[model samples]
Target: MTNKDVYIAKMKMQLDELDGQMSVLEARAKEAKDDARAKYEEEMAKLHEQSKLAQGKLDSMKSATAEAWDATVAEMEKVRDAFVHSFSYFKSQL
Candidate 1:
């Protein structure tokens, strides 16, 4: 397979993994206590938003070449960082 094909495959796999993680997080958030439930929901919402944004970015790169994969990777990294920051802050509060 070509490099672009490989990149697309990898991107789709990453997105699937993120979707699975989001689902698990959502379940955990729903199971949280009354006081902590709000914070958990907020964090889960942030993650869901980031995941949507990341999926959009990945979709936009459908016609991209191997060289353009870098941009997609960078966008995914930003999303990951945001998720980490939000998760960490919420964790610290609880």
Candidate 2:
């Protein structure tokens, strides 16, 4: 379909995958030992915050008009990329 449509679909898919990853990370954090658990919880908390930010961006993107779609996508991607990067690094730790 259109660029806006494609972008929106892609972003939604990415967000879904990111949500699943967050859950996986959450479970892993819960499984850690006492000392490591504290650190994991801190990291997970930061990740949760990032997830919220990304979700907000996604919501904005969904409601954005054609004229504003590009800008919204750019902003959404920034937050999505940060979440992906952080999740990748966090996964490596486990």
Q: What is the lDDT of residue 80 in candidate 1?
A: 58
Question: What are the clash counts of all predictions, listed in order?
Answer: 0, 0
TM-score of each: 0.72, 0.88
**Lowest summed-lDDT stretch of 10 residues in model 2?**
2-11
Off by over 4 Å in 1: 65-73, 80-94
Could you give me the TM-score of model 1 versus the true structure? 0.72
Highest lDDT scorer:
2
Using TM-score, give the best candidate's number. Answer: 2
lDDT of 2 by residue, 27-79 (tens): 98899899999988888888889888988888888779979877887888889
